[model samples]
Target: MKNIVPVKWLLARLYEPDIVIVDCRFQLGNSNSGREAYEESHIPGAVYLDLEKDLSSPIGEHGGRHPLPDIAELAARLSQVGISNESRVVAYDDQGGAMASRLWWLLKYLGHEAVYVLEEGFGAWKKAGLITTADQKVLIPGRFLATVKHNMLAEVDDVRESLGKAGVTLVDSREAPRYRGEAEPIDRVAGHIPGARNFFWAEGRRPDGTWKSADEHRERFAGLEQDDEIIVYCGSGVTATPNVLALEEAGFTRVRLYAGSWSDWISYEGNGVAVGDEKNQ
Candidate 1:
């Protein structure tokens, strides 16, 4: 399954019965803002999925700020929104591609291989003078059974086990400053996991908010080999999915996501933290 699709590609398949367009726009602090934006104007026939409500479970002591949602519950929600196992999901958001990628990752984790993120976000879609709507479209629910893929996830213990390992490479998807311990905005602690390399997730996108090509994505991770096992994470595991998607786009097959991420790492008392630059490739 391709990780991304252009706005026009979605535009052409806009009315397809098997296609389900998702609006994933979200703000970290302002939780209601995403759905508010969707209610105001959205791509026609699109259903809204909130990052906090739909994509994540309640934040626990050890599972990071945005823990992965319950598979059964999420599948039910998808069913309610008319997303079945065969639905060709195209998720879009205004927050770069983070929120949309979160959905893409979740759907893939559930063994729904037909998921994709919009290459250009909602902002770009409106800019192109494409169709938009405020009216909510109703449809009958579809059966969405989730077959969870355990291998695609990396728990904090898995991350700890991979530290300094020869074949496995841990990639911190946060920005350089946060990885360097210069700032601690969201999480309780700064810095990153020990022995993890920095690969800022935003680097996957261009200045205009469009995703880079596969060759460009390959160039971004030129330091990494295609066969190496890559584990990616960010603040609370939300932004990291884009890097995971990019890794797949670049043809890196052995990639997994540390879903708890940095926030969950710091939650444990004995977890080691590292500062300053490590190998950045």
Candidate 2:
């Protein structure tokens, strides 16, 4: 399955039975904004999925702010939303694929390969002058079986083990300031993991929000070999997914997400956190 689907292609197949369009518009601080936006206007046949409610599990002291939902519960939610293993899933959001990529990665982590993030997101759809609707569509539920792909995820232990490993790379996908410990708007600490490198997730896109070409991505990540293990993380594990997608596009195969990321790391009192511009280098 393609990692991205164009707005024109999605418009052409809007009503296909095996296709499921998901509205993933969300605001980090405003929980009700996404649902309210969907209720006001959404693509025909698109169903809403909230980042906090549908995508994340209940936050605890151990996991990050946006922890991964239980596999069984997530699978059940997907089944309830008419998503089977065979469905062609397309997710979109206003935040330049940040929120949508989470859903994209989650679907893949659950062993479903027919999922994609819509290029340019709902903003592009609106800009294209396409049709939207306020009416809701009811879909018959599907029987989606869940299978966990453990290799695609990295826990706090794996991250600690990879800190100074020769063949591993730990990537911090937040902005340079956040990664450098100069400024931290969220989380308790103001720095990154001791040995991690910075690769801002938004760099994957152009100024207009479309993804860069595959060749460009390959060039951006040319330093790494295909066999090297890459572990990506962000403030709370949400934004790092875009970097994971970018790495895959660059032809890097052995990549994993640190789901707890910096938030969970700092929660451990003994964990080492580096604060300074030098740490980013």
Candidate 3:
């Protein structure tokens, strides 16, 4: 299956027993908003996955705002939601896959590659005149074994060591204002990692909210060599997953996610931060 599936394609296979649809809509400020939205009306048979509750562990001072959940716990949750190793998982959110991609990346990190993000999210689904249901479906639990892929994730120390290293590229997937240190609505630090380059995650999407073609992504990321060790990060590591998908779609195989991202970086007192533009580097 493709990394991104459209609403029409998904609608055709809605009743497939092997398919599990996940509603990932979330608001960073209001933690309960996503669940409320899900309760109101979501795609038929779509289970809700809360970003703070299901996808991540409680935040400590060191692990950033959204640390990954324990592998065992995540696996159990997947099983409870009727997802098995062979399940074709489709995740979507109101935001342009920012929250949904976190689940997508988490599934991949757990060695489950049969996952795809819904193109254009829930709004697109509604716009396409697809059916939305408020009735919750009771699912019989399935066994899902989790195997963590360490290579897919980059810890804080790993990102620290990669700074200014030859053949390594640290990408700040936040918007330009945050990367430039002009504004920081979240996190304690107002700047970014010392040597990281900015690549706004929204750039990967078109005005209609669908992802750019693979060829377009290749052109956008042309500066980096295919073999470069690329690490992507954003505020709390949620939004950055879209860039991870974009990079993979562009045919770069050596991509890793800085799971803690900027929030974790600033937690260390000694880690240096850079302000202004890349020209200042």
Tens digit of lDDT per residue, candidate 3, span 65-147?
A: 89989899999999999999999999999999999999999999999999999999999989988789899889889889988
Superposed Cα RMSD, model 2: 1.3
How does residue 210 of candidate 2 score in lDDT?
89
Residue 92 miss distance in model 2 (angstroms): 0.3
After superposing candidate 1, which stretches have Cα over 4 Å from the reference? none
lDDT of 3 at 167: 97
Instruction: Residues 96-161, candidate 2: write the lDDT tens digits.
Output: 999999999999999998899999998899999999999988978988997888999999999999
In model 3, where do residues sit more than 4 Å from their true spots? 279-281
Q: What is the lDDT of residue 89 in candidate 2?
A: 95
lDDT of 2: 0.90
- Model 3: what TM-score? 0.98
Q: Please report how far candidate 2 places residue 203 from its true position, in Å.
A: 0.5
lDDT of 1 by residue, 28-80 (tens): 99999999999999999999999989999998878999999998899999999
lDDT of each: 0.91, 0.90, 0.92
